[model samples]
Target chain A: MKPTTLRSFLPRPAINQRICISRVSRGYAVQAPGNPTLQVFNRNTKYLQKERAASNVERSRQADYLKDEVAMRLSERLLDINRHFNHVLDLGANSCNIARALTLPDPDIDPSKTTSPPLSTRISHLTAADSSRTLLYRDVDLPFNQEINLTRQVLDDEERLPFEAETFDAVLSSLSMHWINDLPSQLAQINHVLKPDSPFIAAMFGGDTLYELRTSLQLSDQERRGGVATHVSPLADVRDMGGLLQKAGFKMLTVDVDDIIVDFPDTFSLMRDLQAMGESNAVLGREPGGIQKDVLLANEGIYRELHGNEDGTLPATFRMIYMIGWKEGPNQAKPLPRGSGQINIKDILGGGEVK
Target chain B: MPTRISPIEKFAKAAAKCSVESSAYGKCIVVDYNSVHKDKCLTEFLRLKNCYLAAAKKP
Candidate 1:
């Protein structure tokens, strides 16, 4: 008797139909034309910056502090939902931070014992997508990587995602959406790719991020050069995010803000760290010649005078906006129609007897 | 009604007006990127920035 395979058991017409279906599904990954008016960031420059930062292993490691912290916070938020995601997409994933956070045992838990539930129990498989190839492969050889199913894909967040509709069980992003030029379109795409009622959790820098640095730089420029240049990139306001998510067709929206204040010895150290983190300004039409030394010196003094701690360290504020929205689905909970309630407000409050 | 141009196009047009200064500044920054100092490309930067600002102000 001849050895038989599962594919061989299928009829020839069935195989041809499967191939045709796959081809049609693959063609659904279309790239939408982005609006040019909203192009505030130079994505090419941002990519080059990320590549350059990732070239130095030591510096990049030092710079991973912010991303790591944000990733941990995002993972904690994911765990709160108590839903197990079979397949998740980590959009704009930097070095698989979310994957690492999920797989690695909690610091407070004992490693040998299984008393506390593992965080990775929440996610079965994660697809970590990022624009920078170097950043994506930075931690490929980590030991914890073996514990989870993680796949890395080099993807530009500025462009339309190359995924089929309703492909992801859930989508999570950390400290990446702020760099995007068209956030509404991105959010809609994210919603489109998520399974029904699946959560889309994300964190982005808010408008108040680095305000101290922004003001100091402006003051320095005005005093020295008689005019101020756009030094800091603009960020999304927390107030606008909920509206954007609602407009994107997500239901049960939750938006909150957090501030991470990091202390540095001086301005130069802070700037160096920002550069190493690939968070340097990528705004179009920005000053090509970097900040002038005299202006920087003046800004250092101004920064210290305005916002320096008593210990002499300069504090840089990073305001983060965390948002959670679920894709609309039929099985999800729905609010009752207005005036449909049976109970009276006065009766519920016990202020007056029911008529 | 006049056609409205995108911000990227407007910036691109302004940048084209100051290409010489922009190239000079770009070259300076790229050359000394690794060991760039505070005042490394002060002149080039200021010139390009001023030119671009002036160009951007025009209708």
Candidate 2:
């Protein structure tokens, strides 16, 4: 599929289509009430479905560049926990990357002469869910375990999960949830579906991701276009992850940032890589015509001056934030109630007895 | 909710008044929206934008 701009997907005008100009636009006499702002990253599912389909095709060429690495990292976290996950749900499981990584037989334990249980034995069932049916159906063969049962479902939407309460032992999403507009609501749904004390681990791009590209684009656009437009989608902040987990009633929440930098020959190559990875800008507010040639050429200079290496290659940073939360249950640890601690902080600091 | 000028129309309007400005790095056509529209209503904005695009050379 060809790379798309905002104008490429704009609905074609019908002959009888009614074009209503707002009253506010009639005369500027009295300012009409401003429309409420939409939630950031609030994109239509149809656009995403199409975009993901294109991306899945490109993913074959780039085979495991960013997605596979992140999925493996997320899978390793699950492996380290040493807990038996009977049923695992890979939310936003595009092409079952996470599921495949999680269920593949451990390299250390050979199935032919395995004295110990393989990693595939830990998870009996894997349900892979994604918004794009194109992605789920594109590839038929999977490197999944023969013993494990794998099911694929096209989710209705990210904000609303269709599953019974306490259905999953673990829920994992790799570099997918950042596109969601209502993250807290999504987290609540994930929390509801997870069995008590079960784990929910996710990895997503962080706020500082692609700062080099963003700065260059803004500067180039401001200089050439008189004003800057939204060229890149905003990523989630690491600090906000903890609060969101708590709001969703998840306990033992942990959020960590992993920064990865990839070197590129130039801005053009970098942009090509983004296109190949299916990570190009798709936000509604992005420029309709896409990046102008001049802006891109100008950005190359700025990119090299600031972020370039001695080898004449530039760097692109991808900050992945890993978030882990556990569903609240009787077995989960709880914080101490107010004034319930045995020792007072004042006594320990002052070396004096408490009253 | 009241409808506003869509993003496509806004981009086209911005592209119309564009003039190629040369810099140290390169040159690009910069569209000055403030100079063109000032403070127009949504309806007026779209009308004036269509007119501007119709008259000006395509960016």
Candidate 3:
């Protein structure tokens, strides 16, 4: 494969360049509310959390297992689609996990021989955008010999997308949408930005994610403090995903749920890992005080007692909801009209002749 | 049928009206983000939450 310069594929417009420069100089600002929109997660706090995680090189590296696993799984789904995307967008691309998954050769592939093409051969260019500048630039200098043309943009997922309509051939996100406040609107924005018939594939934390931790925290908090505060941010349910995508004007929707269980030595270790992963609770109006010492202790005991594994390891479930939707277009497949079939279903099923 | 407004959107709208309370609670948390415990800013948070609910009830 010949090396393609980023400039050769797409030229940067003067106006776009000026916008980028201005955005960089001003830093990211919260959306100026024209119409009243509800705020779910505090974007400023979330950005700070991600920035803190990115600053910790060691902890962040260890916490990347989850992102790496999810990224690979999402990429597999993308590869199943039999089309070459000329320009793809990786939305909420923290640490560029999707980019790494696409560009790097699989472990099974031999490095010496040029017999097999890299996975990224299907995409000619990738744009990685993240709300947190630090996380977006975390792996900027990583050496990938077969790297595809990539552009990094610091963008808040909550705000309106800066790109024009029907710009990207495909838009993919991994483990990001859960933090979005208005998910339906976000999905609509994604659908608007995709070229006709192009796919939007994403994986996010489902409602059942961290049930053990959530339950334990609630139980402990209720017992100790007489009331429970919002410790864990609410996530989207698998059942509602189809409706959301359809409401966003996406056709031919597919939603699947998967669970990844990770073993931690204790509850404290798990919580620390979550922080390192930039997955801390950012729910608005959440209890400001840290988890009380007594509550923490009680929560640990409750967590182990309720959900502990046999070998003394605590199991934490990360429920992932994967969804695929395509923008409507003339070239896409269409189902037949109602009652269009000529053959009777009874004959096919060998059930007797129709009266 | 008209689309029903989601509970999240309702809560968010209410929260938007209580920006002062919300920011006060948020500031308390940010001040001691790493070492925050239960009930550290309970008063501020509860005030914000109450304001949110109250605001949400109107219309």
Which candidate achieves the best DockQ against the true structure? 2
User: Candidate 1, residues B1-59: lDDT per residue as tens digits?
Assistant: 98877554565566557656744654554443344445556777678668878898998
Q: Candidate 3 docking: what grade?
A: incorrect
The residue pairs that clash in candidate 3, if any, are A38-B12, A289-B36, A289-B37, A290-B36, A290-B37, A290-B38, A291-B37, A292-B38
Off by over 4 Å in 3: A1-36, A106-115, A339-355, B1-59
lDDT of each: 0.82, 0.70, 0.81
lDDT of 1 by residue, A1-355 (tens): 9777697776678788899989988865765775554789988899889889888878898989999999888888876686788999999887788888887665456678878665877678889999999988998988868988888999855458999999998999998888898888899999999999899999989989999999878766765676778889999999999999999999999999999999987777788889889888999989997887556645655576667789978899999999999999988988788999998887769877457
Candidate 1 chain A weakest lDDT stretch, 10 residues:
A293-302
* Candidate 3 local distance difference test against the native: 0.81
Collision count for each candidate, in order: 0, 2, 8
- The best-first sequence of candidates by DockQ reads 2, 1, 3
The 10-residue segment with the lowest total lDDT in model 2 chain A: A15-24
Candidates, DockQ? 0.03, 0.05, 0.02
Residue pairs with colliding backbones in model 1 are: none
Model 2 agreement with the true structure over A216-251: per-residue lDDT tens digits:
777666655667788778877999999989999999
